[model samples]
Target: MRLLAELRRRNVFRAGLAWLALGWLLIIVANLLFPLLGLPERAVRNLALALLALWPLVLWLSWRYELTAQGLRRDAGAGAANPVSRRTARRLDQLTVALVLMALALSGLRHFVLDRAEPRGEAATGRALPVGEAAVDSERPPAVPADPRSLAVLAFANLSPDPSNAYLAEGIAEEILNVLARIDGLRVASRTSSFALRAQSHSAREIGRQLGVAHVLDGSLRRQDDRVRVSVQLIDAATDQPLWSDSFDRELTDIFALQEEIAQAVADALAEPLGVQTVRVRRATDDLEAYSLYLRGRQLFTQRGASLEPARSLLEQSVQRDPQFAEAWAALAATLYVMPSYYPDAAQTSFEQADDASARALDLLPDLAEALAVRSRIAADAGRRDEARALLERALTLEPNNANSRMWLGLTHLEAGHVDAAAEAFAESHRLDPLSGIHVGWLGATELIHGELAGAREHLERGHALGWRGPASAWLLKLALHGSDAEETARRFQDWLRDDGRIPEAVRAVHHAVAPAITDPAQRPAALATLRQAVEQQPGYDWTTLMLFAGLTDAAIEEALRPKPASGQILLMMIWSPVDADFRAHPRFAEIAQRHGLPAYWAEHGAPDGCQWHGSPDPRLECGQ
Candidate 1:
C-alpha cells in the first residue's frame, strides 16, 4: 500500500503508467481495426508518430519535477515532503519504462515471428573450394581444411583427332565454366588456365591439389563440323568423388541452348548438400547461326591482333543475323571496346558500333551479366570505377563467375592499393580456373604488392611452367625485387628467360641484364634496337620486346594494356596501370595522368561525374580516361 501510494503520488510514475496504457490501447486498436484503413502500415506509422511526440513532453515535465528523500518539488516553488529519494530507484523505474515499451513494440511486429524453415543452400555439400586455395594449399590445408567458397573449371580434354575444330570442344567447356561461375557463392577459374590444361593429363586429385580447389571439373569435347559433343564430370578433389556428370550433343546452332541446359543441370546437381541458391532461365536464340558466330568471335577475341577485324566482321554478321541476340551484341561490344583500350590505332569506327550494340543488348535484358560486364569495362576505361563497380556488382550478382569483370575489378582495387581485395578477386578467378596464366600472374603480382616475394615467386613459377613465359610475370617478380644484383638477376634471368620455352641465348642476355634498367634516352633507343632485333630472329615474339615496351613511361602504355593485341605484337608489354609503390609519390604520375587525358585526380574516388576511377586518382600510369 505504501509503494502503490508513492507511485500514484509521483507524477513521473503516473505519466509512465498513462503512456504504457495509451500505447497498449493504440496497438490493440490498430491490430483489430488496421484492416479497415486503406494503408495499415501508414496507420501504424501515424500512431507511432503520435507516441513519439510524448517523449519530449515527459522529459520537459520531469526536469521541472524533482522527488527528494523528504519531499516532492514542483515548479510552483513549494518544496513539500512526499516520497523517497533513492536515485537507484528512480533510475530503475526509467529503465523499466523503456524496456516495457520496447518489448510491446517488438511483440507487435508480424514478420519477426519466423515459423517457416530457413532455406538450406548448397553450402551443405556440393560447394567447390576456391582456386587461390592452391596457394594456401602450397602451405598445406589446415589440420581440418574447411570447404572452399569458390571453384574453377580446368581444361576439358579434346577427344577428337581433328585439332582444327578444337575451338568447338573447348567452347562447350568454356560455356559450362561460365555458367557455374554465374552462381552467387561460386567462383569459376579463368579461361587462360582452363585452356592451358588442355595439354595435360593430370589426375583429378593432382589437379585439384595444385589448383587448391576442393572440386575439379574434367571432361572431353568432340566435334563433327556442325555437330558438337561434350562430356563434363564434376569431382570432389578432397575425397576424389564424382559429384555429377553430363554429356551434350547439339548442332552448331543449338550450342547455346545446349550449354545452358548443361549449366542448369550441373548447378542442380551441385546445389543440394553444397546449398547454393540459383535461378536458371533458358531463353532461346532466334538465330542459331548468329549465336555460333558470337562463340567464334569470343575465341578470336582471345587470340586478338589482326584477327580482330575478322572477329568484328563475324560479330557484326551475328547481330545482323539476330538483332535480338543479347549475347552476340554483348560480345560485339566487348570486342569493339578492346581496340581503343588495346589498339588505339584500330579504326575508331568500330567503337561507335560497339557502343550502339551494347545499348541494344541492355534494352533486351537489363540484368544480363554479359552486357553489364562490358558496360563496366567501358565505364572503367573512361575513369569511372564507382559506376564500373556498381555495374560489375550487378553483373557479379547476375553471374558470379565473369573473369573479365573480376580481373578489371581486381585491377581497380590493386591500383588503389587494396592488395588483399585484389588478391581475393584474382584468387576467385583462379579458383574457377587454376590453369589460367592470367589469373596466376595477377595473383603473383597482388602478393608482390605486399612484398610477399616467396608467394609471388611460387605463383610466377607455376605460371611460367604452365607456359606463361619467363619475362611474363614470373621473370618480372623474381628479377624486379631482386634488384640489380647482377649475379642473382642474371641467374634468374638465364634460368627462366634463357630459352623461354625456346629463344636464342646471346639475344636474351642483353634484355635480362642491361636493357631493363637503362631509362636514359641513349640507353632506351639502344634497348629498343636489341628488342626489335630479337623479335626478328625469334620464331614467336618473346617477352623481351614486350618488357622493354612495358617499361616506357608513355601514354601508349594506356592503349597497350587493352585486351586483344595484334597477333604478332610483343606479348611482354601489356599496358594499362601499374601498382608499383615506388612510383606512387613520383611527380611524373601527374604528367602521365595529364597525357592520358585523365582528370586532375583520375584515380581518386568520390566524384560527381559518371567516371570515378575506383573513386580516386592513382599515382601510377594514369587512369587511361
Candidate 2:
C-alpha cells in the first residue's frame, strides 16, 4: 500500500499512461503522414520501434524523478526530508492535467483538422465524389451519354439464415450480369465497378449517376437446405423508382434456369429502350453441383493470389462433373493464363494448360465471348497479332462491355505500335471498369511512356490508391528517379521489390551490390551484366523484366526467345509500352514479325504510328517484312 502511495505521489503512473497515449498518437500520425511525405513505409516502422524502445526509459525516468515548484529533481533519499510537499504535489497535479489536455487537443486536431484536409496529392483531383456530395469545384464534368439500356448489377444481399452462403449470392449476381452483358446493345457495367459500390449507402439514383448508367439492379438471396429464394429489383436511376421487381423460390437444381429466366425477363422488359429483342439464354451446365462449383471457382479466381490453386482445383472438379460447361472452361483458362504472372515458377505448365482449356471452351461453345477473349490472349502471346486482334474484335462484337477483351485488345494495339488505338482501347476498358487498378495503371503507364508527365502522375496516384502496387510501384519509382530526389526513388524501389515476393537472397545481395543506385547512368552497364548473369543462373520472370526496364533489352530479348523457360513473359514484354524501337529495326525483328503475321496485319490495317524512321515511316524495318 505504501509503495502504491509512493508511486502515485511521485506521478510515475500518470507519466507512464501519458507516455503510452502519446506514443500511440505518434504512431497513428506517422502512418498517415509518411506516404504523403514520400517517406518509406520502413520509416514508419522504425518510428514505432523507436517509440517502444523509449517506453522502459520513460518508466525508469518517471520512477527516479519528481516534479516540483522549484524544478524537476531526483527523488529525495529515504533519510532525507520528505519530498511529498504540498507545493510539489500541486505542481505534479498541474503537469498531469496539462498533459491530458494536450493529448485530447492533439487527438481532436488529428481527427477533425488533418482528416478533412489530408494530402492525397494531385492525383486525387479528378477522383469521384462520395455519394450525396455535390462536386466541390465549379468546373462540372462532361455529362455522361445517357443510355437507357445501360445498367449496373450491384452485389446481391446475403440474407440467408447462414450468412456464409454469401458466395452463392455473389455467384448468382455475377452469372446474371454475364448473361445480360451478352445482350446486343446493352451497356452493362463491369462486375468490378458494380460490386465495389455494393456496400455504399448510395441511392440507386446516385449509383446510376456514378456508374453512368440509367438503371441499377440489386437483389437479396436466401438459401435453406436444397431450396433457394431470391428477390430482385430493377430501378430507374434518375427517379429511384423500381421499374421491375420479382421474387423466386426454387429447388437448388433450378438455379441455372432461374438465372436465365431473370436475364431474359430483364432483357425483355428493357427491350424498348435497349432496342434488342430478348433471346433465350442457355444454361452452361445442367448438373447442380458442377454449376455451384463453377460459380465458386469464378469468385475465387477474381480474388487471385493464394485463392488461385483452390480456384483451379474447384474449376477442375466443375469441368470433370460437366465437360460441356463452356463458361467454366473459359474461366479456368483465364485463371491459368494469369497464374504465371504471379507465380513465375509455374510459367511453363500454366500457359500450356491455359491453351488446352481454352481449346476445350472453343470446342464446346465456338462463339462464347469469354472463351474467345482468352483465346485472343493466347494468340497474342504466340506473337500472332493479326489473329489476336480479329479474335478480340469478334469477342467485343458479342460483348461490347467486356473489359477484359478491351484491355487485351489494347495490348495487341500497343504491340503493333498503334499508340492512338492503344490509348482508345485502354480508355474504353477503364471507362467500363473504373475501379480496376490494373486498368488505370496501364492507362497511366501509356501516358508515362508518351511523356505526359502531369496526366501520368494523376492516374498513377489514383492507381496506387486503388490496390495498385508491384509494377505500378516500379513505374512510380521510375518517375521518381526521373524527377524526384534520390531518397524518394530508393524508397519506392524497395516497395516495388516487396511485391515481387521471395526473391533469392543471393540475387538480392548482388542487386544491392551492383545497383545501389539504379537511376545512376554510370552504374547501369555493370548492374545489367550482374542482372543478366543472375537471370541465367535462376530463370525468373521478374529479373528478366527488371533487365528490360534497365535498358538491357537485347539481353532480355535473347532470354525471352530461348527454348527453355517458356512463358508468356516474352509476349508480355513485346506488348508493353515504350516499345524498343532499336530492336524493332533489327533483322531479327523481321523474322519474328513474319512468324507472327505482323506484316500481313500492317498491310490490311495500316502501319502503327510509332513505326517510323528518318522522319518517314520505316517501311522496310518496323512496319514492313
Candidate 3:
C-alpha cells in the first residue's frame, strides 16, 4: 500500500493513464485520416504498433524521472527528499488530467460529430459529395438485403517475398469467389466492388456493412518455392465474429483442390448444401505459368479501355503457352470484341480475330458461359438480333449472376425494341454489379429511354461518382437538356468537351455554341447549322444525338439512315434513342426499316413494341408506314 502511495506521489500512474488515452486517440485519428492521405492500411497498422511499443518506455521514464527546482533528474532515494515537491506533483497531476480529458474529447468528437456528418444513401440518390462513395456512409448500415446468404470475398494479401506472386494470390481468391458465385441462393459481391476496398483500413465488420453482405471471407497467401501457404477466415459482418477459419499448406499442383475445399467450407457454413453438378471446378490447365499469365490478362481485360491491347497480348501469350485453356480463349475473344471501340483503326481485324477466338472456345467447351457471352456480343454487333438473344439467354441460364451476359442481353432486347425487357435486364445487371460505373451508366441510359427523368438522373450521377465519366457525362447532359435546363445542359456539354480529348477542338467549339440553343426554339436554325457542320467533320453518335435534341428530327434521321463508316454505332443509337418519336412517325421511316433489314429481323425475332407487321402487301412494319 505504501509503495502504491509512493508511486502515486511520483504521478507515474497518472502519466501512464494519460499516455494510454492519448495513444488511443492518435490511433483513432490515424485510422480515419490515413486513407484520405492515400496511405496504405499497413501504414496505419505500423503506426499503432509503434505507439504501443512507446507506451512501456514512457511509463518506465515516468517511474524513474522527476521534475525539481534543480532541473529534471532521476528519482531520489525513498528516504531522501522527494525530488518532486508537493506543489510540483500536484501541478503535474493536473497537467496529466488535462491531457487525458483532451484526448477523450477528441475521440468523442471524431466518433459522434465528424463521422455522423459524413454522407449516406448516395448510391440510390446520387447527391454530390467531396469524397468517394465509401465516405457517403461512415457509420450507417450497409444496403444489404435480408437474404442472410450474402457474402463478399475480399482480395487476398500477398505474403510472398517476391511480391510478383500477387497474381497467384488474387487468382486463388477470385477462383474461390467464382465458385461461390456459381452456387444458387448465394448473393456474392462482384469481384471489382470487393477488391476496390482492399486498400482501405476498414475492419471486417465495416467491410461487411458497406458491402451489405452478412459474411466476409478475407485471407492471405504466401508462396515459397514449390509450396504455398494459404489462410482464410469467414466472419459474421454484424458481430465481427469468425464463423470459420482454416490454413492450408500444399504444393502448387493441389491449388485447385484447396480452392474447392475453401469454397465448400464457406457454403456449408452458410447451411447451403452444394449440388454435385453445381461444383464445376474444372482445372483450366496444368501449367501454372500459363494460369498466372491468364490471371494477369483477366485483370487487364476488366480495365475495359486503353488496357485492351496489353490485355490481348497477355491472353495470347497464355493461350500460346497452354493451347487447351478454353477460359483464356474466351477472355481473348471478349477483349478483341471490345477492342475496335478503343482502337478504331483496327476495327475490321479486331472483329475477325474476336470471331475466330470465340468460335474456337465454343468448339472446345460447347456450353462455356463466357464463350457464349462473347459470341452473343459479336452477333449483337452484327445486327443478328435473334442469334444474339438466344446465345445471351443460354449464357445467363448457365450463370445467372453473370453481369456481362445480362448487360449484353439488355442490349439485344433494346435492339429488338422490347424496351420493358431491356429495362429489366439492365436492372438485374446493375444489381449484380452495383459498383460498376459502366453498368450503372447503362442502367441510367435505360431509365432515360423509359422516360424516368428523375430516376435516370439519380443513376447517372451515381455512375459518375463511381468513375464512369464518359458515358455518365453524355447521359446527364441529355437528362438536363430533356428537362429544358439549358444552363445545366450547356455546363455539362462544355465539361465533356474539356475532358474528352478525342473530340476535335472544332467539334468542341461547335457543341459549345449548339448546347444553349437546344432549349430555345428561336435558336433552332443556328443549332441546326452548327450540328450540320459538326456532322460533316465527324459523323458520329454525339453529333447525331445533338441534332435530335435540338429538334432537327429530319436531319437526325437522315444522318442515322445514311450509309456511313460508323453504321454499327448508328444502329445502336437508333435502338436506344428514346426521343425518336418524331423519326418513328415520319413517312420515310420505311427507309430505315428497309435499309437495316428490320423486316427480316422482326420475322426471325418478334417485332419491337412500336412496330407491328401485317403479312399482306407489306411484310415490313414501320410505326409510321
Candidate 4:
C-alpha cells in the first residue's frame, strides 16, 4: 500500500498510462501509414514488437525522473507533498485522456469511414464467395459445378533448414498435380489455384468449396543434405476427414523414384473412390541437378516481370545440363516468349530463342502439350489464326486439363471473332485455374466484349484482387466509366491508380487523362491529346482502346497500322468489342484486315464472326454486317 501510494504521488502510474496510450496511437498511425510509404506488411508487426519492448523503459524513466518548473530532473524523494510532482501528475493524466480520445476517434473513423469506403463484394474480402451465393449473384457468372472426382494439390510445407528449398517442395506437389491431371477420368485443379490457397487460413472444406473440388492433398518435406523425409495426406474436402496418410524416407539421389512412388500411392488410394483405373507418371528428368534447376526456373517463370531474365538463365542451364529434358525446354520457351511483353527491346532475340527452344522441346517429345501451346502462341503472333487454333486443339486433346492450352485456345477463338466460343474457352480456363489472375482477367475481358457488364465487373474486380494489374485495371476503369455513377467511379479509379505501384507510370498517365473525361466532358480534348502523346512515347503499349474510347478512331487505326503493333493479341481481341463497332464499320478497317493477314486466313478457313470475304474483280473483306 505504501509503494502504490508513493508511485501515484510521484506520477509514475499516470506516466505509465500515458505511455501506453501514446504507444497505442503510434501503432495505429504506423498501421495506417506504412502501406502508403511502401513498407512491407511485416514492418507493422516489427513496430508493435518494438513498442512492447520499450514499455519497461518508459515505466522505469517515469519512476526515476520528475518534470519540474526547472524542467526534467532526477527524482529526489519527490511525493504528493511536492507541488511539481502534483502538477506533473495532473499533466500526465490530461495527456492520457487526450490520447485515449484520439485513439477512439481514429478507431471510429477506420471502422465507419475507411472500411465502408472500400469496394464491396468478394474483392474487398479477398476471398471467393461460396458457390451457392455466387451463382445467385446476378453480377457474377454461374459457378462451375463441383466434380465428385476433382482434386486440388496444395503446396507442401518446407521444413528444410534452407528456405530456398521451398521451391522444391512446391515443385513436388505440382508434379503430383501434373501426373493426376493427365488421368482420363479425374479432374485436377490447376496449380495456381491450389498453391494460392496454401497462403490462406481456409480449411480443406472451405478450400474445396471455393475451388469446386471434392478432395485435397497436403504434405510436408524436410530435406537435409543427401537425405529427405516426406509426409503426405489425402483429405475428403466435404467431410474434412483424412482418407489416407503416408511417410517416405529416401536418399536425395532417388528423388525422382520417390515422387513416382508417392504419386502412384495417391492414385491407388483414390482409385476405388474416384473410379480411376490407371496412373502414368512421366519422368521429367534423370539428372537431379537439372531437375532442381528446372524447378527453380519454372517457379520464377510463374512470377513474371523482372524475374523473366533470371528464369531464362536457370532454364537455359537446365537444358544444357540435360539436352533431352523436354519439360525444361518447354519452360525455357515460355519464359522467352513472355519476355517481349515486359522487355520490348529484346523482343526479336527473345522470340527467336523461344522458337528454337519450343522446336527442340517438340523434337525431344512429340506429344509435349506445353511445347504445342508455345508453338500455338508463336503461330498466333504471326497472324496464322488457323494454325494456332489447330495446335491449341491438339494440345488440349492431349492434355485437357492444361490451363495454358485452354487460355491460348480462347485467344485464338477471340482473334477469329468467335465471341461465344471464346467466352466458353475463357470460362473453362478460369474454372480450371480459379485463382489465376490472368485467367480471371481474360474471362472478364471476354465478358466485357460480349456485353455482359455485370459479369465483367465481377470477374475484373476479382482479377484485381488476385494481383492482376495489367489489362484488368484498364478494363475496370472502362466498366466504371460506363456505369451510372461515372463521376464517382472515375474518382475512385484515379485514387486507385495513384496508390498502385505495380502499374506503369506511363500507363497510369494515359488512364488518368481519360478518367477525367468521364466526369467532365470539357476534358475530352485534353484527354485525346494525352492519348496521342502516349501513343508516340510508348509505342510498345497498346493505346487503341484508349484512343477509341476518347473518340479518336482515325488515330487508333493509324496506331494499329504501326510496323509492330503493341500487342498482337490485344489488337485482334479489341476489334470484337462493342466499343470498336465504329472502328470496324469504318472504311479503313478493310485495310487493317488485309494488313493483319486476316483476309488470307479467313479466305483459307471461313470468315470470322461478323466478317464476309467477297472475291471478284475487287478482292475485299466486308465486316460489321
Candidate 5:
C-alpha cells in the first residue's frame, strides 16, 4: 500500500500513459508521412523500434523528474498531499487524453478519407488527364472474368537420345500453341509463361491456377535418325485428370503434318466447350533443316542478351536455307532491330537489314502478323509514328491474341505519348504473357514514369526476379536513390553491379563510374567525364539515363539529341515521363522535340497527354510540371 501510494505521488502511472500516447501519435504520423516523402519502409520500421527502445528511458525520466511551473526538476519525493505533485498528475491525464484523441482522429482520417481518395497501381499510373480536361472520377472498371477456355501448353519433355534436340520438342509445343492462338475464341497462355512454369516443374493444376487456364497440354518427343515419336496428354487443370491422350510415330519430314494433326485434335476436344470453330496451322517452311535452325534461333532470341548474336547467326542461316519462310524472315527482322539496343554500332546496318527482311517476309506472306509487327517496330525507330501505328493496328487485327504484337503496339503508343493507350496495351500484353520479363519490366517502367511508385516497385522486382536485367535494373536503382537514404541505395546498386554478369563489361564499367554521381553531387565532375568517355567508347548503350540520374539534365538532353541509328524509343519515353520533368521544362526542350519530329507528330495527333503547343509570336512546347 505504501509503495503504490509513493508511485502515485510521483505521478508514474499518469506520466507513463502520456508518454505511450505521444509515442503512438509519432508512429502514426511517421506511417503517413514516410511513403509520401518517398522514404523506405525501413525508415518507419526503424522509427518504431527506436520509440520502443526509448520507452524505458522515458519511464526512467518520468520517475526521476517532476514537471513544475519552473520546468522539469529532480523529484523531491513529494507525497500525493503535495499540491505540485497533484497538479502535475492532473496535467499528465489531460495530455494523455489529448494525444489519444489526436491519434484516433488521424487514424480515422487515414482510413476513411486518404485510403479512399488515394490512387493505386494502374489507376494512378495509367494516364494523366490532358491539360484543361475536367478531373473525372479515377475509379477503374471492374475486372473481366477469366476466360474458362484458356489453355497452357507446357514445354514438351525431350525423350530423344541426344538431349541437344530439346529445342525440337519446345519448338513443336510452341507451334501448337501458335496454331491454337489463331482460333477465334480460344485463349492460349503465351510460350514464355507456359514454358517458364514447365521449367519450374509446376504441376498442371498449379500451372492452370497461376496462368488462369482451364486446361494444360503436356507432351514428350523422341527423335532418332529420320524418324520421330510424339506422345501428348491434355489435362483438366482443375482436377488434373487426363481429358485426351494421343501418340504419333512419323518420318521427320512429316513433322508439320504431325503438328497440324495434334493441334486439330486438341481443338476438336475443346471445340464444343470453347466454341472454337477452326484451327489453321500455317507452315512457315517445308525445309526440315531450316525449320530446326529457326527453332534454335528463336529459343536463343527469347533468352536475349549474350545469346542474341548467336540467335542472329542461326536465323540468318535459316533464312538462307528457306528464303520463302515468312516466319523466319520476320524473326530475323526482329533480331536485327533489337541489336542496336545492345550493340549500338550496328544500328544503321541492322535497321537497314531489318527493313529488308521485314519487307521480304511481307512479300512472302502479306498477311503474316509477325512481319507486320516487326515492320512496325522498324518504322517506329525511323520516326514514322503514324506508319508504325497503322502497321501495329493491322497486325493486332489479324492476330488479336499476339502478345508480341501487343507489346509493340504498347511501345508505339508510349512513343506517341499516349500514356493511357500504352498502359492498356502493356497490361493486356502482361495478361497474355505473364512470365515475359521484358513485358513486365516495360509495364513497371511505365508505372514508374506515371508516379505509381508502389506498383512500379512490385512489377520491377518481379521482372528482375524473372531475369529481366535491362531498363528494370536502372529504373529500380532510380527508385532506390529517390528513397530517404540515397547513399545507402547507391552503395547497394554498386554492390549489385559488381556481381551482375548480364550487362556487358564496358557498359558495366560506365555504370559503376556514373552510379556515384546519382547520390553524391561531389562526384559529378569526375563521373560526367567518365560517362562522356564511355559514350564515345560504347555507342550502343543509353547514356542519357545515366546523365539524368546524376542530375546532369543538360548533358542528358545533349546526349539524347545526338544522332544515333538505334530507335530512340527509350530516350523518348524517358523524356516524356514525369521523372524528366526538369528536362522537359528546359528552354532547349522545344528544339529537341522539333528535331525528333515530335512537333510534327503532335501537330497531326494533337498535343500529348500532359503537353500543349503555344503558337503565334513565341512558338514553344509546354508540359505540365
Candidate 6:
C-alpha cells in the first residue's frame, strides 16, 4: 500500500546498493585486514568464509536502516545528535560514507601491505618444481619374435607355501638379473620392465618381443629345514630352446652367494661375457635384522608418494639397528633432503635434520657412495658449490656405474651451468638405466633446461612408455613443452597439480632460471604473450617465464649457455639453433675459458685424445671442457 510504495522509492534502491557495497567493503576488511594485522592462515580462511555468508545479512540490515518518506521506519530514526530538519538524513548518509571509507582504507593498508606472498624461490624451505620425463604418442612397438634367449622368473613358484619366504624367491631372481646386467654388451631385460608382464599370458616369444631382449631367465626356490633348493633355466626366446638348466641345494646362509653364482651362470649360458670383477655387493652389515629392515625399507620406498615419511622413518630405524648400515643411513638422509618440500608442513624439519645426519653418514664411511651423494646434495642446497662438486666427484669416483650417482651428477652439472656436461652425464645415465623413471626424469629435464623440449619429450616418453606413471614432473613438462593443445594441456595440468604430493624434492634450488638474453625488443610482446599463454596452461605458473617471454638478454645467460649442449634444443624444438652451435660450433667459449667462466666437459667422448677441440681452446676445459 502507501507504506510499501514509499519503501520502494528510487532513493531506497540507491541506498540498498550502497549498503551492499558497504557489506563487501566490510568483508574485504574482515578477511584481509584482520589477517594482515596478525591473524593465522586458518583464522583468515575462516574469516573469509564467515564474511562471505554474512555479507547479505549485512546488506539487509543496512537497507533496513535507510530512511523512507512514509516512516521513521524499522531500524531507521533521526540521528541522536541531529536537529529535526532535512539535513539530518544527509548527516546520517554522510556518517555512513565516512565509516565505509575508513574501513576500506584500513583494510587496504593492512591486507595489501602485509599479506602478499613472497615470490617463488623466496621460501628456501619450500619449492615444488622438479624436472620430469617427457611424453610421447602411443605407437605399439612391432613384436620381435625372432630367435633369442628367453626365461620367465615365474613368481618364484611359491614352493614354500608359506608366503613369508617370498623374499627368498624374489631375492634369488633379482640376483640372477643383477648378474646378467653386468655383461659387457648384454641385452638382458631390465627387472621392472620384464616383471610388469607378470600373470599376463605373454608367451616367452611375446615377452621377448615386447621387451626387445633375446634371453629369458626362469627361476624358483623352496625352503625346507633352513635349507633352500633353487632351479634355474635359460630359454633361447627366439628359437624356443632351453640352452641351459641348473639346480642347487644350499643352507639359508649360503643363499646370497648362490644367487650371484646362478646369475653368473645365466650370463654365461646366454653367451654374454663377464668382466673380471665378481658381481657381488659387499656385505656392509652382518646384522640380519638390520639387513631385513633395509630390504623392507627398499620395498616401501620404491612405491613412493604418501609412503615417504613412513619409509623414511623405517629407513632411519634400519640405520639405528646398525649404525654402520651405510646404505640405510645414506638413503634415509637423501629421502629427507628431498621429501620435505613435497609434504611442506612436516618435511621442512626433516630436511634440516637430514642434512646433519647425511653429513655424519659420509664422515663415518667415506667409501659409501650413497652417503657421499647425499652429502653432496646437502652441500649443493646450501650453495657450497665447490664442496658439493668435490663431494659428487668423490661419490662418482667410488660408484662410476651407479645409476643414482650418475643421475645426481648430471643434475648437478645442469645446475652449475655446464650444459654440455649435463647433457653427456644425462645421456650416460640414460644408457645405464633407461627404464628407470629417475634417469628419464632428469635426462628430460636436462634437455628442457637446454630449451630442447623434443629431446626432453623423447626421454620422457621413453620413461612413460616403460609403464611408470606415478611421478608428476613427467606430466608437467609435457604440458609446458607442448603448446598446440592449450585447453587439453590446461586440464592435464590440473590433474597433474592434484598430484602435488608425489614430487620427491631433494632441495629448494632457485637455479635453472631461463635466461633473458634476447636483444629483439620488437619480438618481446609476442614472445611474452606466448610464454604467458604457456604459463597460463601450466599446473602452476612461475616468474621464470616472465623474462623468457619478455626476451630480455643476459650477460650471464650468454656465458652459461656458451658451447651449448650440441644443439639438442634446436633439434628437439624442431627449429635450428641461431648461433653456429646449432649444427656447427661457436667461438665465444675460449675467451670465456681463461676467466674460469665454465667448468671441464664430462661427456662420454666416443674416443678421447683431448685433441677434439683444436680450433677452440680446450672445449672440455673452460668452455664446458
Best by lDDT: 5
lDDT of each: 0.55, 0.71, 0.71, 0.74, 0.76, 0.50
TM-score of each: 0.56, 0.71, 0.72, 0.71, 0.72, 0.52
Q: After superposition, how far is residue 114 of candidate 2 from its true place, in Å?
A: 30
Report the candidate with higher TM-score, 2 versus 5.
5
The regions of model 2 sitting more than 4 angstroms off are 1-142, 478-488, 501-506, 540-542, 570-600, 613-625
What's model 2's TM-score? 0.71
**lDDT for 517 (candidate 4):** 63
Ranking by lDDT: 5, 4, 2, 3, 1, 6
Q: How much is 523 displaced in model 6, in angstroms?
A: 20
lDDT of 4 by residue, 409-433 (tens): 8888777777778889988998898
lDDT by residue (52-112, candidate 6, tens digit) is 6765665465445544465444543333321323443465567668768877786666445
Clash count for each candidate, listed in order shown: 41, 0, 1, 0, 1, 29
Q: Per-residue CA lDDT of candidate 3, range 64-108, in tens?
A: 887777777888756778745576667666876776777778777
Off by over 4 Å in 4: 1-145, 273-276, 480-542, 565-568, 610-625
Candidate 3 positional error at 156, Å: 1.2
Q: lDDT of candidate 2?
A: 0.71
TM value for model 6: 0.52
* Candidate 5 error regions (>4 Å): 1-146, 481-484, 492-513, 522-542, 564-568, 615-619
Candidate 4 accuracy as TM-score: 0.71
Which pairs clash in the backbone of model 2? none
| Candidate 1 local lDDT, 1-625, one digit each (tens) | 8646544445556456556656665665564344322222345667877886886677456446665545545634224553343563565467667757765665454223210110100101111222222222233433444346445565455556575555555566777777676676655556655444333434455545655556667666667767766666676766555677655667766766776777676667768645766545455376767766777787777665455677789888988988888877887888887654334444346556666778889998788787888787666555565676788888877776666677766765554445577789888776555555567777876665555777877877666554455434434534453464545544554455543433444455655544344323355555555555554565232343334333433322322343342222222112222433223323454443443334433445432122223313443332212
List all candidate RMSDs to the true structure.
22.6, 19.7, 9.3, 16.1, 24.3, 28.2
Compose the digit string of candidate 2's lDDT tens values, residues 1-625. 9888777766667777777777777776775665444444466778989988998888788778766656668887444575455455565566666766766776677556553342111011122322111221112222865589799997777767786687798899988998898887888888877776665445666667767889888777778898987777787877776677666778998887888888877887798887667656676777888988988898888877777899999999999999999999999999999888667678889999999999999999999888899889888877677789999999999889888789888888877667678888989998787766767777887787676878877777667666666667767765665564767766777777765443545567765654453556677778877876776687553454555445565665675555566545344333334434445665555555555566777777777675632222433554342
